[model samples]
Target: MKNKYNLLLSLMVFLFSACSTKDEVNIPSDVTNLRAEARAGSIMLRWDNPSDLNFLYVPVQFKNPLTGAIIKTNVSYLTDSLLIDDILAKDGEYTFEIYTVGEGGERGGNTLQVSCTALPRTPVVTEHAEKIDFQVSALSANASDPTEGNLANLIDGDLKTHYHTNWHEKIPFPQWIQFDLKEPVEGVKFVSWNRNGSNNANAEEVYITGSNDGENWVEIGRILPDELPTTGGAKFESKMFYKQDMTFTKIRYNAKSGVGGKAWFSIAELEWYKTWVVVVDPERN
Candidate 1:
């Protein structure tokens, strides 16, 4: 009888220990140094993650500024930053609430809260007040067709002629045409015409870069393949609107490849214009 009683006591103690362990829960610690930074049409949130091993994820809650919808997102514990994009510019501010979640679905007691106003959106150009022609001081190119079409033909104002890259021999692509403006021109956009009779030789990938001293250049604009003119004898006027004007004296046009996978390309004419516009601030209105 004594042995049986001892065995029953041992079994009861094991059962009690298992029940206590299964019911245990761990609550996560709160994030630290949480902050929000405002950007144009977007808001950036960053924080330092908690060192607690039980931390599994974070929940970010906000109301859409453009639409009256509740936004809730789950972020991995390993991530410490988030970018909320496509937010509309408004007179009111946005509020954000963030908290941590633990492995056992326990919520952290502390929640971080912040309010921020995003930067103003880029204003649309209601009208082009003026387009002043800018003079090119010099012209250069990496490769030209040996048989016909000289570099001088690019600015000669003749639609019948063109400037063609080497066709007799294969020239590795990224063929370029560069020009220097007599002086720095601000708020500039360019117009380029394709070869008069054919579009097959037009560049598919185009990038326009600008430099003040002609040594170091920064990308000012890019022309997508669909944006390039598909029909022959057509013109492509850059539609990229700059929020802040860029002033430069030198401009380079790089052709990564020609249409239909050809190595050579052609341009009929190139022109630059100084644009003028007036934007009324929404707050002032």
Candidate 2:
């Protein structure tokens, strides 16, 4: 009877220890250093590793503030960062939560709460009309003759052909090509393609000026060879948005020199963006 009592006591002790171990293994410690950064169209989440080794996975939850919809993701313990993209939330505040899943599927307390806002989308624009019939002038050049080099070539939209100034006939510095947009534009952006030749002759400095009339021009944008590579491909330049969109009927491009001292200012193609406003007629409707 004494031996049997000792054996029974040993079995009870082992059972109690097993249960205690299981309980301890199923509880997870909290995660630390959770952070979220708002980007152009997404949010980046980062965090430090959990102190406890009992966690099996980390589950992140995103909530839509307007629709009350939920998005859930499960990540392994090894993942310390994640980027959530294409979130169709409007320009407003949103929240997210993180929780740690223990070995036995038990979830620990909430680790962190994060809030961020989506940025406003940029406006869409399309190609506008190019002024092909405009006056061309420089300090001196052969721009008058259509057969040789003319201002119309700038807006011809043909990359194979370009407008080249007569460098041998006159000095190439401080050349300009001006045109009438015919109609006023709400806003404008410019793109220029350099002449693609053996030497890759391109503009070293270009200035964009706008005016309501043919005279009294105002500088709206500037492009340098450093900012816009004057070789290989076309260079795109954008104008800064003003307090209110301005209207301009005349646009001019003034060139100072050629990239790498190529002796002339040559442009293959020039394009511009114009904001168009649509008018609805109530009588026709």
Candidate 3:
């Protein structure tokens, strides 16, 4: 009876030990569908969480291609995305690796790896039209009406209004409008919008010129007007020109002709831009 009692006690101890070992052995699930995106100065990473309930967190590793510096981050299981910002480095490829961890601290067998390139930082470009003043050579008149063709309409940000050359007095070719940017800029870009709806008065020959003091101007770019009339009902035509880097405070548009020889030049809107650059560092501001 004593030996039988001892055998039963040993059996109970062995069963309890087996159950505890099974509970402590955690199996981690691998993360899936890892994706990466490149922004202006950062990279965004995303991945699908493991379906296993034992998932606790993810360990992410990033390596700088140039310096080989490794960065490690522990992400909560609840989040599926992360943004690594302010990566200030020369344009080059970078690498990433991800490992999933289980509740019991077990790492997944499979590791996710990805690569992305950092583009060189360039100057930011911003619109500078609102700070400037403008003037036109002539204002078009309709049946002795003068309110429809003011030069201010060009920069009012309204496509419905327009600046038109004087048609009542037969304004000659080479009609022009100019803007004073208030300060000189390193470079400039122009986005010009033609009259909307069916009007044959859109400028056909457009010339962009720039000057420092509004006197001796230099030709920057030109757009020859389309000779053929558009078949669709009058729609606004937009054109863009990127000028070389130079110091200029004034920009001028010289229109030589109108679509279908309408003997008038009209502009619906205009936008101006200036460029700038930024430097970045991953470890510092």
Candidate 4:
């Protein structure tokens, strides 16, 4: 009978010990630094790190507040290593929150809020561009390489374009590359950014030249940014075309200069500026 009692007591002790295991996730700091940047027609989400946690040991999930769309991914050491690009947002209010994934987890992560004017202004083709068989070839350089590229290298120039060759290289200037529109208008009126150089003085250069027949360029204007490269090499997508109707063919954008001070300039797309709000008929609302 004493043996039986001891065995029962031992079982109770074992069960209690099993239920009291130390939590594997030690959330020292959480408050995901979520940031939202609006560019072109897309909005980018930059979130803080849940990274230091175990890789395969624990999985993370991202949920969309509107659609409830959930994405499962692993959290490593890289911060904001994930991007949400499903953009169906209109001009309104939106909010998103992040919750930590536990081992069958509990809520302890980060949350952030941002407001955006998710609208874009596209230009009305005054004259439909007659497609020309033109291809642009770009050549570039840094403090390390200095031979800049051309329209063919930056963008396919055969389409009806608005700018031509624009090249601007200077001291204390960001390294850049550009696509010159063959047509001429005003100047670079819009300023949006994606992946810029590595510093606050955004190391990107944009200059202008004027031409009529897509050849014979002349320097006219430029836009030098004041930003830097991402500390992490994240893919940046930004656009800063034009807003008011101007005239110029030869527009140039240079990025990632040999110039130092945390700068790099990368562009995925560039377009001509057109007014975002257009009234077809003033009398009709």
Best by lDDT: 1
Model 3, residue 147: distance off in Å is 18
Give the 10-residue window scoring lowest on summed lDDT in candidate 4. Answer: 157-166
Ranked candidates, highest lDDT first: 1, 3, 2, 4
Candidate number of the best TM-score: 1
Candidate 3 local lDDT, 1-285, one digit each (tens): 999999999999999999999987877888888888887678889999866645889898987776788889999988888888767446477788997898878888889988886544444444333223344432222322154567668777888787777777676777777766656765555666667774677777777777886669888777665632343224433333445566777777777777778777666776666533344443343
Candidate 4 residue-wise lDDT, 1-285, digit = tens: 999999999999988777665545444445366666765434565666545552222234445545676656555334453444434344243454444544444445454455543334333333222221223442223322233223333243222221212234333443434444444444443333332232233344455344444455555545454433333222332333342454555444444342244333333224344222334421121
C-alpha TM-score for every candidate: 0.52, 0.51, 0.47, 0.33
lDDT of 1 by residue, 26-135 (tens): 66888988899998878899999866645889899998666768999999998999998766567458899999998888899899998888887676555462443434
Relative to the true structure, how large is the alpha-carbon lDDT of every model?
Answer: 0.80, 0.66, 0.69, 0.41
Question: Alpha carbon lDDT of residue 143, candidate 2?
Answer: 38
Model 2, 1-285: lDDT tens digits are 999999999999999999998877656766778888887567888888765555778888887766778889998887877787755336367687887888778877766888887554333443443323333331123233235476666666677777776655655466676656656766566667767663366678877777776668787777766776645556555554221557787766777777777566677767666644444432122
Error of 4 at 97 (Å): 1.6
Clashing pairs in 2: none
Off by over 4 Å in 3: 1-24, 29-40, 43-57, 61-86, 90-98, 107-123, 130-172, 175-203, 211-217, 223-245, 248-252, 262-285
Candidate 1, overall lDDT?
0.80
